[model samples]
Structures are given as structure tokens and as C-alpha cells.
Target: MKNLDKLLEKYAKLCVKVGINIKEGQPLVINAPIEGLEFVRLLSKNAYELGASEVYVNWSDEVLTKLKYKNSPMEVFENYPKWKADSLEDFAKRGAGFISISSDDPELLKEMDPKKVAAANKSASIALKEYRKYTMNDINPWLVISIATRSWAKKVFPKLEEEKALKSLWDAIFKATRIDQEDPIKAWEDHMGNLKEKVDFLNNKKIKSLHYTSKNGTDLKVELPIDHIWAGGGSITSSGVPFAPNMPTEEVYTMPDKYGVDGVIYSTKPLNYGGNLIDEFKLYFEKGKVVDFSASVGEEVLKDLFAIDEGAKHLGEVALVPFDSPISNSNIIFMNTLFDENASCHFAFGKAYPTNIKGGEDMTDEELEAHHVNNSLTHVDFMVGDSTTSIVATTLDGKTLQIFKDGNWAF
Candidate 1:
């Protein structure tokens, strides 16, 4: 926790300069938890210093959100306010740079009715469908970063008191984002360069499919779309501006063919979904659909997730991360997808990113579906890789190759 303020100032600059890479004349919109007010102020100041046209912060407090769920009738969760959706559309149309400060309490809604949570989630996703396309398609810049809150920090460092846990969690976050280093931006450039190497390799190989096996009883294979692009480290806007989507990203990922997956996969870590944790889950797939599934925890929530839409039962993304990755070495479970998903190999259910496929940007939703890309209202990621995992690829040459050995990338 030494130099906490100094580290935070550096973090704010990094989020503006490197994370979202805000353009000079573009406005910035931030979605932040009230607990992160101090950091949000710093972030807005940095954006203004970089010549951002304006800064808007949308404050969210989970306590109020949970209160609504507790007191509102069932019908209340079934509909979302159209005015809020329209406001987001207005921002995206003006080419706003967006940042999300996520400090989630892993078990905040543990005792809430799963049905209510599911309904609210579905309604919001439906209403915001248009606004989501901008970030999903890389039409505008977007980034997700985190700060430590009492509940979230305690979840990560359970044995410590509130203040101690906050300090420890902040330390973990700084190290993960390299904000603890002398020059975080330069460190990120070096990290992205390494990720670019893997991207270039995968693109050059023209891989057909990947076969995976692990000690946790995972034996699955997922095929790549004909023109799928492997992307990681950074992303570019439709107009050519570059930005990093996830501050501490370490995975190279692409969409998998919606109809070309088979076998089974097991979760290596708890999946924190809508404040509920689904742990020790096993999903069985056949020809790309999740035919059967089981979870030792939050089974009802898992069911509601799959019920979101037909595409929810199919694979949208396949990502690769080394077992010896920095986050993995830290031995801390942040219980947040942005952090945990980067710690190991993972897969997403529901919508596939439009930018993942060649010419996908201009293709209509129907066209994308015809090309075998899964589409849904939600995209949820869960970890599955460990040191015992191995992935074999069938290249364009029609032969088996080792893409991953012992959970790390293999030449």
C-alpha cells in the first residue's frame, strides 16, 4: 500500500492514455461503482488533461440495486427503462470513449431470487442491444479496470481486516496492471509486443481446429471459422484508433464455429455471474451445443444463464492463456471475470464478437448467423485451463500439431 496515491495517479493516466487511449476531441463516459469515487475523479481529470471534450460519470451503487430486487414486484424486473437505453445510444453516436470500473461483491446477491436476477439481466440486455454493438464491434474504444472495495477486497483476502484487505487488494491490482512499475505504459507496450507475436503466429498458421485435454476431465475440440482472426493485447476502432480493452490481458482469443464443438469441459474456478458464484461446473457438449450441465454451486443460476437464449447453450469464444501467467502465479482469486478469465484458458458462452471474423463488421446479424457465428444477449466467460491441460491443433495442412503443451503456448 506504499505510495497509494502516487500509484493511483499513474493508474488513472494509464486508463486514459493506454487503456481507452482517449482521442483528443472525443468525450468520455465512465460507468463506476460509488466506492471508486476517488479513482473516478482522478480518471476524469486525466481524460481532461489529454484534451477530452467532456467527461461523464454514471454512478452505480450495488446496495441500491439490491434494494430494488428486494422490494420490487416480479413484473418490475421484466422491463427496462427505454430512456436509459436511449441515453447510452446518444453517447455512442457521438463517438465517446468508455471505461467501466468494476469492483463487484462476489456474493452480494447470494440470497436473492435467481429468477428475479435473470429477468432483470435479460431485460437490460434486450434494451441495450444497440448500444452494446458499438463496443462489441470495436466501433468505439472501451476498457474495464478495477479498484478495491470492502466487500470485494475481503473476498480476495478473507483473513485480513477491512483496511488491510483493501491495501492488499490494491497491491495485487497494481502489480497485475503494472501500475506498480516505474513506467506502466512502457511495460504494457512490451507485454503487448509479446502477445502480438502469438497473434501473428496463429494468423500465419491458418489453424483449422483445436483439440484440448486436461486432468480435470476436459476433452473438447472447437473448430475455427474460416476467416477467424486471433486477437489479444489491444484492439482498434473502426476508424483506426488503437486501444487496450482489458488492462491486464494475457490471452489470445477468437470465435469458435457455433456448430463445430464436441465433448466436455470443466470449470477450474468459480464463475461469478450477476453476484452469484457458480463453481465446480461441468458442461457437456455435442456439435457445439451444451446438451447437459451440472454445477456443485449455483445450479439454478446456471440454468437461468442457459435459458437466456438458444445461443447461450453454444460456444462463442475460445481463448488461450498460459498456466504460468502472471495472474496465475499470484495465486489470488479475484472472482471477477476481467481478472480471472485472463488467469487461465477460458471460453465464453452466448454472443461472439463481430470483429472476430473477417468481413464480420459489415455483415448483418442474419448473415453472421448463416456463417455459423453464435449470437445472444449475453457473453459469459468461465475458466477451464490448468497445468495439466494440453491443446492440439489441426492446421490447414490437415495434420495434428501442439498448440499448447502443459497449459502454455507451444511452437
Candidate 2:
């Protein structure tokens, strides 16, 4: 009917065609916030046209969860719905592909305890991992993409009405995913190629240690092992070929040395947790392990997170993101690390990256611990990126090389 409507329709077609690779006679699963119901309906029509046998949608809302936070007992935080686990298991068993749209209310969980939030996150991931092992073995396809919902869209542009805000977010999402490109699939191919170059650079450098510094929080240095692989470009096909993870992703990450990190760092953005958000989060690290943490708004939650297990305090991801990203250039404060960390470099605590370690699963706990690859169900990423953030590499020969300055690549 209109240019915008045509674009929206094309975007939906692209998602189903390229993003999900919809197949005939296959069942489709969609998980989105209520604001996405309209788009989900549109997708359902396209899915059915492409021979989808069934299209199931799970519409979510923060209001119900808000009600729980306002009324449920504190102990309810530790519990999870059994049906959710069962459903995911069944989906995996049925060889169904999943497409989850993420547009979380960044501040909704600001008041919740970090520990409870971490526990809940860990529980879901553990169940998903269990299901994934079976699904991945069979090469059952799945895809996840974050769409801007009204609640989150409003947070991004406070001045705009909810509908306009949602539209603005949609614009950004489409642009970031290269949906505007004349050839979107080709754009991804080139983008992934650039990431491969970065990964190759890190591998060739053979950096033994990474050093970081910034105002208000960081003076951290971590020793990396030789086995650690700098991973990006989503990952590989079950057959061990490369593929994209998220459409807009541009990051090169590695698993950090479990016992080789030392410093105190402040999170650049607030973290959404449980049903609350934590801000002004500061953490102290000793030998690649989080020894203590504090957040100005949700200190209680932070404490609970550290209590999950001994390995919960360990670091999982260490990623590098250039400051010149289109998102960072907007100078918008997202308050959501999932989006913000991509604006600059960041790290995470908890579960190690399986791909980073060689034969990690077969290794004994003692052997794994020796390499600083501890096992934990919790892996939460936080943004430590900042305007003055700088990173340098030190070779085993004591040669120093500049890696990043003001969030840009120095190499």
C-alpha cells in the first residue's frame, strides 16, 4: 500500500526466507513480546504460504512479570515453571526450529536481586543446553533475533510516543541487520569476512596477555592460554562450516583464563536482571575470578549471583568491540549490555566458551581448572566499554602492542 508497508513486508519475508529458512511441512515457533503480535501474524501468513504445517506463537508481556515482582514471595525467584522446560525439550525432540525475539524492558529488573536473576538465567540455559545437545546432533535448525517492543522502544527514545518509538527501533534494527542492502545475504557474507580477518589477526599475534585501563574502574590484565580461540561469525554449521549468529553482530570473543585475571572494573551500562535492573555495577577480580561485586541499585542481587557456585565467580567471555560502531556513534545509552557491549568491548562472568577450549568436555575438572576453564551454568555478559577504554597486548617476549584506543582498533 505504502513504501513503509512494502518495506515491512519485505523485511518479514527476508526473516522467514533467510533468517529462519522456512521449510515446507515444517512447524514454526515464534516467541515475541505482545507488541510483536502484528508482525507475528504477518509471519504466520508467510510461513503457511511456504508450506508450514503449524505456526505457534508465544506472546510475552512485562506487566505480568511486574505483577509477580510486586506480589510474589522472594523465594519464588529460585523456582521455574516445569512446563517451560518440558516444552523446550519437546520442541527439540520434534526437530522444531525456534525464533525468539528479544526486546526486554531494560529497567524492569532493576530492583531484583542479582543472584536470583542469575539463578533464573542459569536454569533456563542449562535446560536449553540439554535440549540443544540433542538437537545440534541432529542438525535441527534454530534462529534468534531481537525485535524492538514498545516497552524497550520507549526507553530508547523517551520523547517519542510509543508507536513512533517502536518505528524508530524498527528502523535501527532493519539497518543494523542490513535488511536495507540491495543484497542482504551478500552483506552478511562480507561482514562475516571482516570478522574472520579480526580473528585471524588475534591468532597471528599470539598474544600472551591482554591489558586494559579506563577511568572509574579498570586496571585489569589477563593471561590467555594458547588453546583459546577467538570466535565470531556466529559459528559453524553442524558439519563444521561458518555461519552468522546474529544478523547485526560484529564481535570477536574468547574465553578468558579462569585464574589469570586481576582488576576492579565498573560496568558501563546497567544490567537487566530477574525482574529488576542493576546499575553502577562494580566488580573486583582476582586471578580471573570475581571475588567481590557491588551495584549501586541492586547489591543484594549481585551477592546472590556470586553465591551460585564457586565457578560462578569465574569469567566466561572476553570480547572486543570497536567504538566506531553505528550504534555507539549514536551516543545513546541503552542500559542493556546485550546491545551496548556491541558498541564497545566487554567481558562476562560464568560459563566458559566451549569452542575456546580444546576437548574441554573430556578434560577432568582438575585439568580444566588448571587451564582456568571452570564449569558453571551461569554466563552473564556486562558492558565495561567506555570512552577512554584502551587495550594492549603483551607477548611472552615482553613485547607490547597496542590493540585498542578510545574503543577503536589500534592495530
Candidate 3:
């Protein structure tokens, strides 16, 4: 086997330098499954080298999580540890940059009760609402990335030997993240520049609404807020530092008016939420709220997700990604949102980000609500873009423009 350590170190450095853009004297916080300890250690080392003053790691274990779900009472699922939420709030208050690593077994909680999973997720979100606001508003830098783990690798390559599967998964991750490039940082710089150009074009058009259609029974219209900001590739922090929120991101996204969406859409890929896989799902919307939904698998989990809160039924984010992107071309399901969401166009339900609008960062909760930005304790992304999908945008000046055709950029 080749020396994987060097590649891992390089990947860590890229994340520290480009993902969160850790600054001098800044604190860094990491949340990851304990299986990612090796990469976490490398990341911590890289953060310190980048002049981070302190680094805090919140380690999690899938086995422990499984045990809790199996043995804990139902009430326990309705409460999140206050100390953990407070720690996140403290980090946000101190302007700490965050890097979250996902490397857990995709089906670890597959057998657990969907209601309990939803309850726990909702409780945690409610507990960390303030922290979520900070990150969502770009008050603090935050990044989400995935690492290859034994269980996750097995899920992706069930036919392969354990060691071979891990290697294949690692290779795919590296390529998707551009870590395989000769100069990964430089590659990211150029990639981000191209995405920014797209964002600028969209912003210049001042799109009023987007019309989506596909052969797969998807026909939806999404209204954009007047001050909607199309963000992609990388985002600037309150301090003017740039950071990439998702390592291999290829989408330009903005929040939609919570009450301005209407139509029906079908999922193009499976959504693995809370360790359960919801596949072949279709959602019907009326006035921007989910009126009905069904899934071929994990239907109960889908129902539990919508019951999280009122905002959970409304569209919070609408993101556009070409079908021929590197991740999509790889033809890997991934079963992970960080990768799948970027592979195709997607929408997030619940908890719209305040930073998605102009002057939104400073807006009060009521003010944001007045703009029709949904607020809730959950945000989940599901893919709906495929080769048959097409989209048109209506500009504020009443000009109609084709944005996507055959799942790629149109004009």
C-alpha cells in the first residue's frame, strides 16, 4: 500500500487553508465521528500551523449512538445535553471557525425508531439555534467535509474486500475534493473563481422566480426574495475572510420565499437522513409548504422529518448544480448529502439561512420572517436534478431566461 498518511496530511492542510480559512489567533472547533481521529489529528495540527490559537474537538462514536438509541428512554431523545449546546454557542460567540467531518456508517441507525431520531435531531437543533444562526449568517466560518471510514466504505462498495473498498472510497473522495490535483489549493482557487462568476451573473439578472420541469413528474415554481443573494464556492466571513462551506461544492444557492413555492417534485437520489435511507420520494407543495409527501422506503422517517416543525414543510434553500459535475460523472451514490447535494440540483427544507439575503445578517428574527425566510430547527437537502430536468428564470425586469437544460447550464 502507498503512503496514505501524506495524502491525508495534504487534505487536512487544504481544509485548514481553504475550507474554513482559519485565521491567526482564532479558535478552531471540530466535530467528527471518533473513526476520523486520524484525520482530525492532522487537521488539528494543520490548524495550529495556520496560527489558530486553540483547537477543540467534539468526538462522536456510532456505536455509542446506537447504544443510546437502543437503551435510552423516549424522553431522553427529546433533550440534548445543554452543556454541548452551550459549548457550541460559546464557540460561535468567540468567532471560532468550525470544521465538521462526516465519516459514519450510513445505516448505523437504520433500525432505530424514526420518531426518536427526529426528536433527537429537533431537540439538538432547538438547543443550538443561536449557534446555528451565527454560522448561517456568516458571523462565523463553518465547513463540512467527509472522510472515508470502514463502514461508510463498505456501504459504498459492498462487493469489494474491506481494505480495497476503503482505498476506492478514499480515492473517490480525494478526486472529488480535488486533493488529487498537483496543486489542490490553486485548483480550488480557479474553481471557486468560476463559480463566483456564475453567482455574479445570477445576481446581475435579479431573478424573480425560477420554473423547473422534468420528465420525472417534477414541475415546480420557486420565488426568490427580492434581496436574495446567490452564494457559491466560497463565502466571506464577517471579518472579511473567505471560506468554503463544503469542500467539493459546485452549486450556487439562495433561499427561496417560504410561502412562494408551488408544485410537485420527485427525488433523483436517495436521502440518508439520521442513518435511514429515504428513497424515491415525491413531495407536493402548495404555497411553498409541503402539502403531501411519499417515499418508497423509510416513509415513516420522511413523515417524522416534516413533523419537526412548521418550517420543516417549507422550502428554505434552492441550489443549482449541473448534472455533469465531477461528482456526478463519477456515478457514485455516496449516500451522503455533502457529496450527493453537490452532484445535482437540490432544495433544503426548513431553517433558511439569514445570510442568503442582502442586509440579512443584521436582520432580527421578526425582520427575516417578514421577508418570508423560513425559520426552524432543521435543514435537509435532497436531490431532484437529472438529465431530463430543465429550469427557466424570470428576471425582475420581466425577461424570461433559460438557466438549465438537460441538467446543465443553458445560457
lDDT of 1: 0.92
lDDT (Cα, 0-100) at 68 in candidate 3: 92
Candidate 2: segments with Cα more than 4 A from true spot: 13-28, 42-56, 71-77, 93-96, 109-129, 132-142, 361-370, 396-398
TM-score of 2: 0.86
Global lDDT of each candidate: 0.92, 0.72, 0.92
- Between candidates 2 and 3, the one scoring higher on lDDT is 3
**TM-score for all predictions?**
0.99, 0.86, 0.98
lDDT of 1 by residue, 54-167 (tens): 998889888998898799998898988898889888999999989998888999889888889999889988999999999999999999999989989988899999999999
Q: Return the candidate ranking by lDDT, descending.
A: 1, 3, 2
Ten-residue region with minimum lDDT total, candidate 2 = 236-245
lDDT per residue (tens digit) for residues 1-411 in model 3: 456887898799999999998988999999999988888999999999989999999999888999999999989989899999999999899989999997778788998877789889889888988788889888899999999999999999999999999999999999999999889999999999999999999999999999999999999999999989998999999889899999989999999998999999999998989888899999999999999998999899888888889999998899999999999999999999999999999999898888899998888989999998898889999999999889999999999999999999997
lDDT score, candidate 1, position 210: 95
